[model samples]
Target: MAGVRVIVTLNFPSPEAAEQAVAGMAQAFKPVLQEPGALQYELFRSVDNPQRVILMEHWASRALYDQHWNKQMREQGAPDQEQARALSPTFEFYPQANYDLVDGIWQPLDPADRMTTIRWA
Candidate 1:
């Protein structure tokens, strides 16, 4: 199965707020990085707009992604919309075939080959 990709954009009210939010989020990132099937999770700040932050995540499979969500629900419950709104976060998910890092480049799997699920650590 292709891994799941999640892209989240956070637009804060100000650069200071974004910086503070990033610092707060840093505390949460280590635990996530230690989770099973967490292929990659990274945060980036926009060079032109310091108030903008972007998160990129990859999971080994849809099942793992769902597991992560369930775990979050059990631990933190649903996120507070009011608190989330303060940061203006936009999230997007892609469930299609994933790419492989080959020779320092990302290479998409052949459509026919992608039907067979492959796991990457």
Candidate 2:
């Protein structure tokens, strides 16, 4: 994929922990806004389950996203992976896809037709 969208779902042990994790991630997001190739970053709280939190990020490329993740942000006052793990021990990272709106329609940016069909389970 030329660009990538990463979706991460974190399942906290409690609602309080999930809220705390969101606060920590809000702080962590500051540096990401300044980082190159960081297109968009958003955090969502699950209405059905208060203990669940989701993070969606759009990057110029997978390599750039990897580079950003590789950086140590603890010294910069951002919560590190260990701290996040402490808050939410179970997390799920969805497969990345490159997609965008073209003429107000959702379309794959890359040549591959990975999202050609919508499968409803």
Candidate 3:
């Protein structure tokens, strides 16, 4: 089964709010890290934009990710729709067949995999 990666970007009104949100998220997700099929989960703050936060999550498979999501909704209740909209979060997903770690470097399993290249301006 291919691994699933989700990138979630959140925009806050201020740096203080972003920091608070990050702290809250870290606390809330502590148990999620222990959930089965949870491959990786990390939160990062944008250096250039203090009001921005990024959540990087990887699941062992799509089914596992869905199972986690369902469990969260069931346990925590569905998030308030209006409140969630106010946060203005964006999300993206990537499905990868395999990954490799060579010489402390992470890369796709297939040598010919055309990974996206980011060119910083």
Provide the TM-score for each candidate, comma-separated. 0.74, 0.63, 0.77
N/CA/C clash count, model 2: 0
What does the lDDT read for residue 99 in candidate 3? 63
Candidate 1 residue runs with Cα over 4 Å from true position: 96-121
Model 3, 52-117: lDDT tens digits are 999999998878999999999999999888877877989898877666666676656655453542
RMSD of each: 6.6, 5.9, 6.2
Per-residue alpha-carbon lDDT of candidate 1 for residues 29-97, written as tens digits (9 for 90 to 100): 889988998988888999999999998989988788789889999998998889889877898988757
Worst ten-residue run, lDDT, model 3?
A: 112-121
Give the residue spans of candidate 2 off by over 4 A. Answer: 73-121
Candidate 3 lDDT score at position 25: 91
Compose the digit string of candidate 2's lDDT tens values, residues 1-121: 5567788777888899888879988997887878898888899999999988888888877788877877754435565677678655443433455577777766666656555534333
